[model samples]
Target: MAESNIHTLVHKETITLFPVDYRISRHAIFLINRNNIDSPLPLLSEIMRSKGFKVTTDQEKADYIMRITSYVTMPTNKNDQALPYSAEFLLSMREKLPVIKPLLVQSGDSPGEQMKATAKLVHNSNQGILGSDASNIISLGSTFGGGAGGLIAGAAASVIDTTASIFSRNSIREGLAGFEFSMTKNSGFLNQVSGLNVYAASATPEKPEALLDAAIGRAAAEMERD
Candidate 1:
């Protein structure tokens, strides 16, 4: 692993809080209740910008008025019809703390030509959170930030087999992410769900918040496709 690449894993992040009053920017967007310092909101904003959904105040001109909420669901067990294949993952990499990357971004059918489009897609490997489960939603707070994140990363790094040193990016994609959206208002095709629904992680062993984040990212990436 190149030293330069390692920097991607750990870098500086300024926890910018959403405007308590209203989000006003040249790009119109109204983000509601996504205040978690470490969360899908930050990830969502990144996705919206990448997809041409400008972020700003002046809901009058906004393409999408999105309200994001994080929810926790019932736990899963071996017998519970195994989570959708997309939500499960396992990683065995030489670099234990390699920076986790975002979902593979791709432009999809835009809600409208003006609001729907995506930028270049770039990323490494990790989970299968692409268009997966619903009811088995989970919380991601521990995976991305707290101690569990640290522990999970550390474990993957050390899981390398000593005898069979050939660890060719052993990975299991986690697609255990889903959302429920409903639009309240629509003047143009650009106006999407009145509410953007996204959940956290399940109680599984390796619920990378990135998956949930990626789930949100993937949805936003493909949201606008005409």
Candidate 2:
């Protein structure tokens, strides 16, 4: 089939996709560089092994070389205590997709890019969940009166609701949330390819493991499905 670049947004789901007609079985030797605490190579390695790929430590001897390009893009200052600019970073990512996208169209089998493999991960966290108070405002306005003032108040409340929802509903849920993974590959020669998938879920700071488990579980499911 023609080269493909796919982006999927899933809630509480980790998506794993192979080439259009390919399954997760050709991974004979696989390796991903573990560079940080947030790195998930071990989790993925387990899944890959289950699908028949042998994990290798010697990169020069392996056929699949996985590189993680994951990073935290917000709250550069650990003490900033404010919400990191996730929305801004996402906007920037959207802009850069055109340049970064071409690299992800290739599959692990051919990796048309003829380049090595790399995956980009973007993560961010905030104090806690942010919820909209517009509905509460509407309720208060309605309870107060019923004449022109009520009509005017209702209209104003509706507008407020819409605006507030826009900011509160941008998918940046509270407490340790991560959003996307853009996988790019180079053939180490000429052509290149990549695949992108967006995953959504958040866990409380005190329950970080919950998020990790959720991701691993979703990944396994996606691997099986695709």
Candidate 3:
């Protein structure tokens, strides 16, 4: 098959949390919790610190406040029978952040599977959100900071390549749906921000958390490039 013909089945979306020009320092505090999943605050703190971000307890010294929460949403769709339950993972970053990313992982067929899938989906979603946040800070800086037009062009090309890769893997795309990712090019970060939503089917293996860890590791490795 041609390289262009290959795709990964994984679905993803990213909202512009900080405007492309939003000023963000290298300090943050995680005030994250969840009604469904275990506390990810410690894990997030460690991850941020490993990326050279100063994890502060003081809100005054933090550049951003990261909040993550997960919950089950009752059925709003008529045909969502096999996956009636919506396991949602929401990530917010700002002074009074709102849900910038609302990732949905559908439940399984039976009630038992649905509950298990919901937990997996929530965990994985949290993982992906944190990992993406780390990498995005650098990517946004390169595109929005003080770079040439080529910088943005390169970023756009990268986005296209990523989408191609995801769609190439049939397995990754399998059992996944309602996936959406986008950002505003001209929005200022000082006032309003954008959100991304990643929706997937069956909250099973290779959960979104795995995807997140991989992305975050890559991004953390590149922090020194800044």
Candidate 4:
């Protein structure tokens, strides 16, 4: 009798979201790597908790998993110069239990005078519920869009959504939104990153408790069906 590797197999699901543009994505990756140099595990664990999901560093124990990545791309006019570069982001979700149906969301926008505009648009489009104080999270800068002036403008929120659907099996929905306001003298980094130089910042749910409840409800409903 063969060992029951099948029964031992811990069924799981995973989703990965990454930035679309090469330059911005690379820079964002650098920032994440740099900031998380001390301990990446904790960061991942926190993110999972925020989304109302359990985290196990061990891959074998994971029943469902999701990953998200984000990057910005320069928007070009006929002149081939930066106008309002579009921020391109991608998400991939995978599941092993029940079935799998991967989903994707792509969004672009002309940087607005206020980060809230862009943030709200992206967040709402991605089906993210915003907090009552969401407006305080984003800070828009003049050069946020794109221009000769290379500066780290205001601050923006980073929202990534990767959760299973309550109504359908093997279905997934994901989204991400952020804005930056401020000016930095790191022209070299901006030039090296390529594409639009978008600022990236960490985010906390405006109403964490509400979001958690929603996430739990959805997850429980899905589990019941399974």
Note the Cα lDDT for every prediction shown: 0.29, 0.29, 0.31, 0.23
lDDT of 4 by residue, 1-226 (tens): 0221100011122221222332221121111211122323343234335544454554444432222222121222222221121121111110111111111112362212222333333333333333211222211221322342222332332310111111121111211122221112232343222111122211221121222223223332333333
lDDT of 2: 0.29
CA shift of 116, model 3, Å? 18
Leading candidate by TM-score: 2
Q: After superposing candidate 4 on the true structure, give the runs of residues whose Cα lies further than 4 Å from its correct spot.
A: 1-54, 60-64, 68-208
Candidate 1 deviation (Cα RMSD): 15.3
TM-score leaderboard ranking = 2, 1, 3, 4
What's the true lDDT of residue 97 in model 4?
11
Q: Worst lDDT window (10 residues) for model 2?
A: 131-140
My TM-score estimates for the predictions, one after another, are: 0.32, 0.35, 0.31, 0.22
Where does candidate 4 have its weakest 10-residue lDDT segment? 89-98
Task: Tell me the tens digit of each residue's lDDT in model 1 across 10-42.
Answer: 111133222233222333665543323232244
Find the candidate with the highest lDDT and give its number.
3
Model 3 poorest 10 in a row by lDDT: 135-144
Candidate 2 per-residue lDDT, tens place, 1-226, comes to 1121222223321333444542335433344332232323554455346545455655565544443221112211112111212221223233221111121232354432111111111121111221110111111121112221111222565534632443353322122222233232323653232223323232112222222233334443554466
Root mean square deviation (Cα) for candidate 2: 18.7
Model with the higher lDDT, candidate 1 or 4: 1
